[model samples]
Target: MERKRDYMTVQELTENEKYKFWYFKIKECKESGLSVKDFCDKNNIKPSTYYNYQQKIRNILC
Candidate 1:
């Protein structure tokens, strides 16, 4: 029999963890040299989520 897998909710991640997660994602996007949509499509990440986080991080920095 196969067992189920558990996943943590976004609420469970600390603010710093969330920052690091998005930071890496943005860095990966830059290094990949692919358009945001293309990179997100290849990684199976929601493009909206990527854009939202990018804006959030910018806001935090400013």
Candidate 2:
């Protein structure tokens, strides 16, 4: 069986596009007020990745 890849690297996405994509996703996830684990599970994102994305967004915002 062929496995589906979950995501792309920075080089694969334009800077603004990457920021916008995760910005909305993280915004929506946080708005739900779900635990990180539950949110990741619901959104099909890995815990570490969710965290990394959060940090990345924070860095971008600040």
lDDT of each: 0.90, 0.85
Q: State TM-scores per candidate.
A: 0.73, 0.70
- Candidate 2 TM-score versus the reference: 0.70
lDDT of 1 by residue, 1-62 (tens): 97765965567567779888998899899999999999999999999999999998888889
Where in model 1 is the C-alpha error above 4 Å?
A: 1-13
Residue 17 in candidate 2, Cα distance off native in Å: 0.9
Q: Give each model's clash number.
A: 0, 0
Candidate 1, residue 48: lDDT: 96
How would you encode candidate 2's per-residue C-alpha lDDT over 1-62 as one tens digit per residue? Answer: 97877986677568778778888888888899998899889989998987898899899789
lDDT of 2 at 38: 92
Model 1 C-alpha RMSD vs. true structure (Å) is: 10.4
